[model samples]
Target chain A: MASIELKDIVKIYKDRKRGTELLSIDNVSFSVDSNEFLCLLGPSGCGKSTLLNMIAGFESATSGTVSVGGKPVLGPGADRGMVFQQATLMPWLPVWENIAFSLKLAGKGAEERRAAAQPFIDMVKLTGFENHYPAELSGGMAQRVGIARALLLNFSVILMDEPFAALDAQTKLEMQEELVAIWQRHQGTVVFVTHSVDEALVLGSQIAVMTHRPGRIRELIKLDLPRPRDSTSAEFNEYKRHILALIREESALARADAATV
Target chain B: MNWLASLREQRDRLWVPVLLIVAWEIFSRSGWLPPSLLPAPSTVCRTWADWVFSIDESSQANAGRWIHDALASSVRVFVGYAIAVVSGVLLGVAIGWWRWVEKTIEPTIQMLRPVPPVSWIPLAIIWFGIANKPAIFLVFLGAFFPVLMNAIHGVKTVDRNLIRAAAMMGGREAQILRYVVLPAALPSIFAGLRIAIGSAWMLTVTAEMVAVKSGLGYVLWDSYYFLRYDLVIAAMISIGLLGFLTDWLIKLLMSRILHWQHGQTVQGRNH
Candidate 1:
């Protein structure tokens, strides 16, 4: 059975002043098996993040159902954890406190919260920086805290909305490696949304390349590469070239549609 | 040498205020206006010292009574400001987090906020007659609005993602407010507290002037009636000193609570 399912999900945003309805997600259906790292790849404004939000239960699909672990997602719950693009951390809280915030909600004591947060801190390689405030940390460090905070939930699935998109290229490469290593160890499902072709090639178990504007899945390509994917490898470049051509064709068609409008 | 370098760097800060005092003393002694009319800074200091220390009772009725009067005024500000802080924060969180609370109560509060706290004097007098009660009630009114407004702004402006994060972590609605919303809104709440403290002092003094019989403002008004300009100047200096000290205390507390805000804000440089 699929660990998470999005069946015929449609999202329509109403623009009140314009008196118009804009459909964002167009009857998109997909599922992720247990422990699968499915990268939902698409262009900007293609409602990819909107799709992840639905699975995380931050948004409701207008016309379809989202279910995780055989239960319909009525709202956000601890069963699913999410790491946002911008490292949305509490500025007042130190790294350890931010990581253990959910524990605090669970009415855990200081000792317990500290204990619960330690393993995740080590998992994200932010061990020494536990007491540092978000403002004091580098961008990559803050995002590590974000990752640690999400992992501390100990959920079945984690939703990542381009969590590494803002990192410097070198830092991004390192974090991707660390993320894969963590996933290999802990073994949980992840739905990572990204626009970067290389990021999709490196991270995803299966790549769901999406069409633009009222997005639908164009292809679901299961990756069969070895661990620690070498971007310069011939097969890796072949997949990149193929995805690039598909994207080029998609963008051209989008432009043609815009010209008609 | 390290200490000396630090003092040298801040030398102008010391000298400028000293210079102003010296110039004022010289002008006051120049006999342009009578000593009663414009007492020298030294003369005011001497009278203030007599009032505080009762050195031969130079300030007469208020001799060694400065502490008592100051404490009385401070108590009113403390009680009233505490009440305002609790009510303002609670109502603010409610209004910011819940539409029903905002729809029901916020319009009334917004309307009342614009009506100056001083204008409530007549009703304050009638409702809570001549004593600490009226003064405190006025202070409450004065301190309430800034706290209320800031708390509302703080709650409303909390990052939506933080709430979303909290919700995803199995946090209930109340848990979101307690764990997520409160912490996120705190810097702004502290901003409100600072502004409210100033209002607390102002309203306390104003209340003393009109209704209360004891405190610095009463002493100032009382001395004015007797044409004791020296004592008046001493009282003004006392108020100014106390206000500065209170503000400094709040700043110290703010730095402690908002230590994470350092190197991120423009005001971070001063600390």
Candidate 2:
């Protein structure tokens, strides 16, 4: 059975002033098996994040259903851990406390929460800076804390919504490498949202390319690159070129539609 | 460069006060204004010493009464401010977090807010009588709105993504509110508390002047009846100093609690 499933999902947002509905996601369907790293890659406003949010249970689909581990998702719960676009760590909480927030909410006592959070903190390589507040950390360090927070939840499925989009280029590359290494070691299902074709190729086992607004899955391409895939390799280039062409085609079609309007 | 450095020192900040005192003394001795209306700063100092020390009964019924009166005013301010803080935060968080609560309570509260707390003095006197109760009631009235407004703003303005992140972690509603919402709203709540403290002091003194008779305000008014301008000035200074002290205390508490926000300080580090 698939670890996660999105069956004919649709999301419509009401434009109250205009009395018209904005269709965000249209009949999107996909499934992820256990230990699959699936990247949802598209241009901005392609509803990739919306799809991720539905899986995370942050947003409800207008129609259709999302299931995790064969159980339907009712609302946000411990079964699916999510890392947001921004590092939304509690500013008042220390690094360890933020990482252990899920356990804290579960009413685990301080010692247990602290104990459970340690491995994940080490997983993210943020061991010594456990007591530092979010404000005291740099942007890259904050995102690491965010990753640790998600990992400590011990959920079978992890959803990341542009988690490294705010970081500097060098930091983004480092985080991508770290993320892949973590995913490899942990072996869990992941649905990552991104606009970068290179990022999707670097990190994903399967890439789900999506079209512009009223978003639908354009294609789901399976990648056969070996572990520690080289970005400069011919195979990687070929995949990148294909995804780039798909995105350009969508953008040109969107522009043509806009010109007619 | 050395002169500029010296000019920027703390001692330089005191020059104006010293110069003002000297000018006041010269003018008082010059006798352009009646001493009964405008006493010298030295005379005010002498009366203040006697009010505190009671060495010669210079203040008559109010001699050695400084401690008692100041304590009474501080107690009223503390009690009222405490009540405001607790209730304001609870109600504010409720109104901010829940749409139903906001729709039901917020408009009424906002309508009542613009009506000055001072206008409620007659009602306070009639309901609580001329005692600590009236003074405290007035202080509560004055302090409550600021705390409420700020708390509401803080809670309402909390990053939506943070709540989403918390909810995504399997936190129940109560857990999300207590663990996520409360801490995120604290900085704004503290801002409200600071503003409320200032109002607390102001209302306490105002209430003492009319409704009660045992604070620095009472002493100032009573000294006016006896034509002791020096004592009146001394009482005014005492109120000002006490107000400054309480505000400083609140600021100290704020800094200790919000030490996590230290790195973003604009002026850099403190010595």
Candidate 3:
């Protein structure tokens, strides 16, 4: 059974100043099999994040349904964990508290929360920094805390919206590797959103390429490349080229459409 | 080496106060102005010591009344500031969180905010009589707005994503508000609290001058009538010191609560 199903999702944003309705995601639909690492790859403003938000229940579909494990999403719940691009860990919370934040909300005692947060903290390699606040952390470390917090939620599905996009190249690569390892061990459904084709290829079992505004799924490319996929390999290059071409074509069409308007 | 660096920093900070004192001493000794009108720093210190220690009756009725006056003023400040902190934070959070509260309450508060707290003295006096009640009421009026404004701002400006993140972790509305909203708003609330403390002292003194008759402001005013400029100067210095002490106390509390913000000093970190 699919872990997440989005049936004909439509999201229209009212632009009151422009006197028009902007269709951000138009008739988008997809399904993620249990434990599948799916990436929604698109250009900026293509509603990839919007689609992820819908699945995460951070957003409501204008005219469609989103279900996780056959349960329709009513609002943001513990069944779906989300990691934001900005690593939105509460600035006032220390690393351990952030990781165990969900448990805290659930009224778990301090010791239980601390004990539960430990493994994920170790998984994210932020063990010693558990007492440090988010402000004291480096960007990469903060993002690690974000990931740990999501993992601690122990949700069946984790949604990430460009989680590593703000990091430097080295940090992004390192995080990508750590993410794959974490996901492999956890085996949970992941709906990742990103603009980077290479990032999609590295982390996703399936990459859903999306077109520009009034976003529609252009292609859902299933990648069967083996684990620890080599970025420099010919297969990786071929996939990257195909994805890049798809994005460029969409961008060109969007530009032409803008010009006509 | 770190101690030396900190001492150097301390010296840089002390320069302004030192210069001001020296300049005041020079002006008072120059005799351009009447000595009675402008007491020298040394004379003021002597009067202050007498007021505090009761070494002599140089300040007459106010001699040794320093402790009582300081305590009375501080008590009013504490009561008023405490009420302001609690109510301001609660109401601010409510206004920020609930649209109905914001619409109904915030506009009225904002309208009242522009009128000076001092301007409410006559009304406060009439309502509460010439006692601590009037002083405290004035202090509350003065201090509440800053705390309320900051708390509201803090809650409103909390990163929306953090709330979403909390909700994702099985947080109910109350849980989200407590664990997420309140903690997230602490830094801003602290900023408001600091600002309110300053206003708290200002209003306390103003209240003592007019509505109340037992604090440092009362002593200052009473001394002026007696033509005891030295006592007036002493009272002024006492108020200044107390104000500084209260502000420092607030800063200490803020640092303790917001120690998380130390390394994130890039923006919105400093009070």
Candidate 4:
């Protein structure tokens, strides 16, 4: 059974400034079961982020439906936690305060917010830096704060849009390991979007490959490989090779379409 | 050593004033101009001390009356500026947030903004009479627009993603405005406030010269009529000193509230 569902979703953006229409998502449809880590793999112009936005209720589908826990989404709610490309932590808030921001909006007392934020702070491995402001933090540290802020919400589904795309490779690898460990403990559905094939193979329980501009799903592949998946493993390389070919074909097709225009 | 370092910093700040004073004093004593026409810094200092302390009542009418005049001007600036701060911020939030509010109110305000505050003297005098009321009205006129313009900019330019993040966190519209938009808009609001306070002091003095008669401006004008140029210079110094102090007080308050901005702002970098 699906924990999250998207049915024939279409998103058309009206570019009023350009006096044109942009078809960002073209009838894309998919779902994830509870506790499934689904990586949305796509090129830069693909609608993977748009699909995630619709599921997060930060955007509306032009057609069809998005349902979480069998209930249709009308708009953004506390039930869906989003980790954006940038940390997007309020500059005014320190790490602990940012992690507890949802509780603050709920009118929780300062002591309660402080107490509640502690576990997630530890989950993100940012225990001693609770008082540091966002500007004072490194990019990876700031992204950890962003993740903790979402984790404290305890949503059944977490949506991440290339959250660690800005991190250095070493930090990214460490963060990916920490994320999978946290997910194992939390046991929630996650829809992670990234253009990185290695990232998809490393983290995803299922990978959904999307085509470029006016995006539609190209393929959906499930991973049954064991935990702590090695990138150099034959199974991992096979999945990476298949995904790379799919994306390369999609990009080449897009370029051909552009040349014709 | 710490005191010496701080003193060196102070000397770097004070050099221009010291040089200007020395040049003025030398020129005055050179018999290059009539001493009566342009009083030396020493003479002005003496009159200022007399005005402040009533030492031998040398200032005659204004002797030891410095505090009263300073307080009077401060009261006018405070009241008028308070009114401007409230109305400007409120109206600005409305204008920036809602299209209806912007359409209905913004054009008239933009039109009125260009008219000089001093030009409102006749209307202010008629409406408020020749007292603090008229003076305060002018100060309000001067301070309101800058605060309003800045508040609008602050609200309009708030990052869209913050509002989205708040919404995702269960914030309703009012809560989003209160928790997210207001905090995001605060730095810009402080910028507007700092500018408006300077305008507040300017209008207060200009109003004192015409509509009101008990502040530093009144003393300056009165001393000029009596040919007491030393007293005139002393009153000028008083206005300058008070203006500087008020602005510095606002800066102190701004820095305290905006402490989070320390690492992110240009001013913070300077510090």
lDDT tens per residue, model 4, B170-263: 8898888888887889888988898999899899988988888889888888888999999999988888888899888988998887788888
Query: What TM-score, over all chains together, does every model reach?
Result: 0.96, 0.95, 0.92, 0.97
DockQ, all models: 0.83, 0.84, 0.77, 0.83
Question: How many clashing pairs does model 4 include?
Answer: 0
Isolated chain A: TM-score per model?
0.97, 0.97, 0.97, 0.96
Report the C-alpha lDDT of model 2 over A95-192, residue by residue, as the tens digit. Answer: 99999999888889999988888888888888899999988898999999998888878646888999999999999999999999998887899999
Between 1 and 2, whose lDDT is larger? 1
Error of 2 at A5 (Å): 0.6
Global lDDT of each candidate: 0.91, 0.89, 0.90, 0.90
Interface residue Cα RMSD of candidate 3 after superposition: 1.0
Residue clash pairs of candidate 2? none
Q: Residues A1-261, candidate 3, lDDT per residue (tens digit)?
A: 239999999999999999999989999888999989999998899899888888888889899999999999988888778899999888887899989988888889999999999999999998799899887788999999999888778646889989998999999999999999988987899999998889999999999999999999999999989889899999999999999999889989998999999
Candidate 2 is graded, for docking, as high
Candidate 4 local lDDT, A2-27, one digit each (tens): 39999999989999999999999999
Tell me the spans in candidate 1 whose CA falls farther than 4 Å from its real position. Answer: B1-10
Lowest-sum lDDT 10-residue window in model 3 chain B = B262-271
lDDT of 3 at A241: 94
lDDT of 1: 0.91
Pick the winner on lDDT between candidates 2 and 4: 4
Q: Report the lDDT of model 2 for residue A71.
A: 90
- What's the C-alpha lDDT at position A232 in model 2? 92
Per-model RMSD to reference: 1.8, 2.7, 2.9, 1.7
